[model samples]
Target: MNKVILIGRLTKDPELNFAAGSGTAVTRFSLAVTRPFKKDETDFINCIAFGKTGETIAQYLTKGRQLAVTGSIRTGSYDAKDGTKRYTTDVVVDSFEFIGSGNNGGAGRDQNSYNNGYGSSNTGSDYSNSSSNFGGMNFEEDMTPVDDGDMPF
Candidate 1:
């Protein structure tokens, strides 16, 4: 029952590190989620993803890329060097989806086609040419004859 979903843009490139004992990959980043009603307000959230999810995020995502994350809130406290107890809250990412065009190498391609899981190896391709068709769907073709019975309305 402890789940959180957020859509936002990355504040900077993800920082990838490995656990010293187990060598497990961990990625940390911040997200700037804008308020729905308040145009000038935004919330900065700290997020962390582990294992393969963390690796994937570090490899393909970058600063300014939009993303949707589903995860749970984790809270903890640690003793600082100043001998003060510091409390921390982080979103432990369970899964994530790429939103809009990524800020990485695959430019001029359909951003939605880049959607993938944490373990997926698809790196995506560039489609800079105007004549290129997406998955064989021709935009110029007349398909008015297709039935509209499937419409829920």
Candidate 2:
């Protein structure tokens, strides 16, 4: 029930790290999301991706690139050196999709073709010139001839 979907640009390149004990990949970045009604206003949201999802994000995405992120909001609190309590809120990314064409070495290729799960070995050729079929229906196969006289309008 705590799902969040955001379409925004990365403020900077994602930082990728590994958990010391588990060696799990962790990627962190900030997203600049503009307000729908207020053009001049924007929000910088912190986001984190774990495991293979994190690795893919760090590998393909960069600053100024648009992304569609699906995740959940997580909030936490910590004590600072000044004895002040600081609260933090961030999106824990479950999945993400590339939004637009960029200089990420995958131009003119399908971005969504890359698998987001672990052990995905997608190459550049794997996404090149890919096409999507809407609703699993091929328009050419579903067409039916209609007569002009059948129209009531």
Candidate 3:
């Protein structure tokens, strides 16, 4: 019942590490998932994957790459050293897929290139370590303003 499926681009490259016990592989990353709106807002979700899925992702997935992840939502609570109770929750990914282009500014360009091994677009910028030039694809500017009167009471 706590299942969640998400398709989004990684904010950065996944941090892959090995657990102390059994040397199990663990991959942690954040995903920028947008809602169905024209505005430039996104929900950044914390994700973790273990075992083979984590290994595969760590090997092939890169920063800004689009992906589809299926996982279960988990919640936990702990006490801080300052005598405060903290609640934390995240999605535990079990499976995932390599979707389309990188979330870089040049989206469709990479999608066609990476998918077909031929890049036809003229992206003068490279996104090896960054996705800065999504070609003026400023997500924030695309948002539509909400009328003040539309506020729910």
Report the Cα lDDT for candidate 3.
0.61
Candidate ordering by TM-score (highest first): 2, 1, 3
Candidate 1: global Cα-lDDT?
0.66
Q: Model 1 reaches what TM-score against the true structure?
A: 0.70
**lDDT scores of the candidates, listed in order:** 0.66, 0.67, 0.61
TM-scores of the candidates are 0.70, 0.72, 0.63
* Deviation of model 1 at 19, angstroms: 0.3
Q: Which ten residues in a row have the lowest lDDT in candidate 3?
A: 111-120
Candidate 1 C-alpha lDDT tens digits along 1-153: 887877777888899999999999999998887767675677899999988778877877788776667778999999999999999999998766564554564233323322124222234431122331223444235222212232111
Reference-based lDDT, residue 133, model 3: 21
lDDT (C-alpha) at residue 13 in model 3: 84
Q: Summarize candidate 2's per-residue lDDT along 1-153 as a digit string, tens digits.
A: 887767677888899999999999999999887667675677899999988778878877777776667778999999999999999999998666564554354343434644344222333322323233222333235434223232221
Root-mean-square deviation of Cα positions for candidate 2 versus the true structure, in angstroms:
11.8
lDDT score of residue 86 within candidate 1: 99
Please identify model 3 stretches exceeding 4 Å from their true place: 103-153
